[model samples]
Target: EPEVTQTPSHQVTQMGQEVILRCVPISNHLYFYWYRQILGQKVEFLVSFYNNEISEKSEIFDDQFSVERPDGSNFTLKIRSTKLEDSAMYFCASRTAYANTGELFFGEGSRLTVL
Candidate 1:
């Protein structure tokens, strides 16, 4: 079975630098999303993208963030300016169909750490 994959399972960056976390969502899936777990917090949705545009975004998705489908299988999340608070496990998830109400399959996660 196909599964979501994330790169650089761990990343370290200086504050104010930009970082782009990468993910390959399950093949044949349509809905893609980025969610973050801030250290010891619950996973929170950052943004959801479909049809090449953002379907929904949370308040946490401020000016510093952007999502892109740079290619057929790759989805990316860019943080323009990292902060200490940005330290977290950024998860990339996808569902075959959101309307199905099934579980969202997530990547192992890209752990981002800002110094």
Candidate 2:
């Protein structure tokens, strides 16, 4: 099956640096979302985008993080500044539709390590 893929399975960056995590989501999908899981915390939704604009965003998606669909198949998340709390696994997910319920397929994850 087609799946979302993220580059650089693991990234180590110094604090205050910029990091751009890339993801190629499945084709023919309508909804895309960004979620993060801290070392010992549950997966938390950061933001959901549709129609080329943000549909919903959680408090965690602050000024530091921004997302964009650079092209047809590519979606990227840019962190302008990194912090120790930002060290976590970032997951890209896509769904065929935003109906009552649908399974969101996620990439293995892009692990971010901030020093």
Candidate 3:
């Protein structure tokens, strides 16, 4: 079985700092996505990427945020400036293909804490 892996399992930063969350998705997956869950809030979609281009994005992915697949095996999300509201658990996910019953596999999550 394969799964997504995220780095810096936990991050603590100042309110105005920058943060880069990294992930390595399943080798054969075609679609990759970044999602976040603020404490006590629902999971929210940030963006989706495929074929090296952004396929879809939510309003949450603002100018302060960016994603890149820098290489074939890794995907990364960068936040230029952190805010107290940016504190949350960021998740990386992937799916091999779209199917009526398909499911997305998620990484353990990178917990971001802004002081």
TM-scores of the candidates are 0.95, 0.96, 0.95
lDDT digits (tens) for residues 1-115 of candidate 2: 8999998799999999999999998898889989999999999999998989999999999999999998899889999999999999999999887544877899999999999
After TM-score superposition, the amount by which residue 78's alpha carbon in candidate 1 deviates from its true location, in angstroms, is: 0.1
* Candidates sorted by lDDT, best first: 3, 1, 2
What's each prediction's clash count?
Answer: 0, 0, 0
Q: How much lDDT does each candidate structure score?
A: 0.94, 0.93, 0.95
Best by lDDT: 3
Query: Which pairs clash in model 1?
Result: none
**Candidate 3, residues 62-113: lDDT per residue as tens digits?**
9999999999999999999999999999999999876235889999999999
lDDT: the better of candidates 1 and 2: 1
66: Cα error in model 1, Å:
0.2
Error of 3 at 55 (Å): 0.7
Q: Least lDDT summed over 10 consecutive residues: which range in candidate 3? A: 95-104
Compared with the true structure, what per-residue lDDT tens digits does model 1 show for residues 1-115? 7899998799999999999999999988899999999987898999999989999999999999999999999999999999999999999999986647877899999999999
Q: Which runs in model 1 stand beyond 4 Å of their true positions?
A: none
